[model samples]
Target: MEPTGSERGPARYEPGEGCVTTVVRVPVRIVVLVLVVPVRLVWDVLTAAGRVVNRTALRPLGRGLAWLWQTLIVRPLVWLWHTLVVAPLRWLWRTLVVAPAAWLWRWVLVPAGRGFGAAVVWLVRYLVVVPAQWLRTYVLAPLGRGLAWLARGLGAVLGALVRWIVVVPAVALWRWVLAPAGRALAAVVTVLVRETGAALGHCWRAAGIISRALGRCLAAVLRWTLVEPVRWVYRTVLTPVGHVIRDGLWRPVRQALRTARETVRQTRREIRRALFGAPREPEPARAVVPRREPGGSGTRTLGKTSGRDVPPPARG
Candidate 1:
């Protein structure tokens, strides 16, 4: 048995079997990979070595360059900006712009406005308010009072003129024309009546028989017309009614008024006593004055029995 196919495998060797060498055929790309793997590994190792050298050796050499850039170049530029540019600009703005404006407002504008306001106030007081007050007090008030007085005088004069011209004339006209004429007519009627009465009296005396009858008839008519009813009403109605009111109604009212008056007086006295402690007692009557004797200089007092003048009873 020449080496079977299974024995051709490297791990598949049998006992007493002949050694068989087998060749595996590979592609060109795999063969090239076989050839390039060691070179690629060596290249990677060389790059790693370069990175270590750069970390240890080259990074330290560049640090001085970075320190020089920050110290010498950047610090000087920042210092110049702060000292030369920023500080001067800030000072210029404060000194030239803000300070001048504030100074002008504080010193010039504020004082000018204050003075202008004071001037306006002064002008208003002297020109407007003072003049107005002066005019009202000194001129207008006096003028108004004078005008009122003149108007009052004019009204009084007008009233007097109207009274004298119109009222007096009307009263005179009534007195002169109407009143005297009325009086004259009334006197003429009175004279005519008296003359007629005298003529009737003479006729009555002359026709004595007829006069007696007519006189009796006229007197009876006059009594009936004017006197009898009046007398009867007075005696039977008015007098009795008056007596009844006086006795029944008016007497009680008068009595009640008297009682009320007494009550009021009593109440008043009680109130007066309550408020003022007590009513004062009336003063004693004064003594009568002694008469002066004729031809005597002093007064003489009358005595009880003697009828002689007593030396003016010792003055109380």
Candidate 2:
């Protein structure tokens, strides 16, 4: 049979159905249908009656009541508000507040602010800027020049004294006594450094040979005592044991865990289905509506214009 509006969706899936559900479902469905038929019929009758009464009586009555409210109560209230409250408030704001504020800002505050700003500018220029300029130009400039001239003279004198007293004596001492001593010491040091370098090279080569032999002996001992045995044990014993445990014990435990998890999940789903109904299917997507161009009322003529084209009346 073709499905009705109420039965248009896909059928609900039953998971692992058994004997008890099959026996109970048909009889329960029959009893429910029988009990529901009269209630459904009564609901449909009442719904139709309500629609008829609303169309015939209530809609007109509501419209009449709305019109009465708009005419009697709303119109009078709006008029009273405009006359008693809004107009007086507007006049009071314009007269008492706006006029006084405008007069104060224009005649008193603006002029006073301008005068005070001018006075401050004049005071700053005279008391601060002019005096600072004068000091910089006359007093500080002359003082800096005199100090620079004195410093030049002192620097020249000090430079002459330093060159004669310290530089000359030091140069003489280095040239006469220290130069000969340093030359002799350099020659001795050069000979000693050459011999020392040769000896160090021989020692380094001998040490390298000794260290290579020692490293080889240690490596052989470690290979025999630790490395080879550890490698053999890991390869011969640990690898096979690990493989046995993985195959014989771990894999079965993992499989049992996975099966238990799946069983618990299925049980939870069944319990939820028993408590609530099946989850609803998603609604079908609505068809997209194409955009429509604005429609014209009629074809335009040469002399006639649309009402919208007329200019609004000018406000006074």
In candidate 2 the C-alpha lDDT for residue 67 amounts to 100
Predictions in order: lDDT: 0.73, 0.79
> Which candidate wins on TM-score?
2
For residue 198, give model 1's deviation from the true position in Å: 24
The residue-level lDDT of candidate 1 at 43 comes to 53
| TM-score of candidate 1 versus the correct structure, residues matched by position | 0.24
In terms of lDDT, the poorest run of 10 residues in model 2 is 2-11
Q: Which runs of model 1 end up more than 4 angstroms from their true locations?
A: 1-206, 280-316
Pairs in clash, predicted candidate 1: none
- In model 2, how large is the Cα lDDT of residue 81? 100
Q: Least accurate stretch of 10 residues (summed lDDT) in model 1?
A: 17-26
